[model samples]
Target: MPHLTIEYSPNLGDFPEADMALALNASVCASPEVKDESDLKTRFVRTRHFQIGTADTPRAFVHAQLRLLAGRSPKAKQDLSERIAAVLRRMAPRPDGTLVQLSVEIVDMDRPSYVKESLG
Candidate 1:
């Protein structure tokens, strides 16, 4: 199972959360470890108030955390993270004069402790 959460600064203008989620889900599902695309879940959150250290310069950021059930090799995790980072970079908007930093982190969820339910 893959759970993704993308947090972005509010100043990032007309953020396309839905489109980003679609792209990210596709990227994650491409992995051999992922059994089905429907198993991937993503949600976006906007940070209403954030600060970039002491720098007053116009800066923004979009950070994504991808959580997966533990057991994958290190290389697999790294590659999966890299794929997501590339997708985030492509989707992130380069606003005029705004320093935007995009990043992704891969978190391993305890497989035994994780639970999911699919209901109709």
Candidate 2:
């Protein structure tokens, strides 16, 4: 299972969260580490209270977190992370006078404790 979460500043000015999620989902699906694209899920959360560097200047940031089942090699994770970072950098809003910071992180889910039950 791969879950992608995007946390970003609210002041970014009408960001297209839905489209961004779709693009990221595609990016995740492109990774060789992922088994299935249908299982990929992505969501975005806007943060209203946050400071970057100096409070006086208008600074923004987007942080992407990807969680997947454990057992992938370090190279696989790094590849996925780099792909995601590229997508984020390309999609993130660049408001005229604001400095935006982009970052990506990959998290591993413990296979022993992780559980999933689907009902369809």
Candidate maximizing TM-score: 1
What does the lDDT come to for candidate 2? 0.88
Give the runs in model 2 whose Cα sits over 4 Å from its true position: none
Model 2 clash pairs?
Answer: none
Q: How many steric clashes between backbone atoms does each model show?
A: 0, 0
> Which candidate number has the best lDDT?
1
1-120 per-residue lDDT for model 2 (tens digits): 898899999989888888888888888898887777888888889997888865698789899999999899999999999988988888899999998998889999999999876788
Q: What does candidate 1's lDDT look like per residue over 1-120, in tens digits?
A: 788899999999999898988888888899887898888889999998999979789999999998998899999999889878988899988899999988889899998878888887
Q: Which ten residues in a row have the lowest lDDT in candidate 1?
A: 111-120
- Cα RMSD for candidates in order: 1.1, 1.2
User: Per-candidate TM vs. native?
Assistant: 0.94, 0.93
Model 2 residue 92 distance off true place after TM-score fit, in angstroms: 0.7
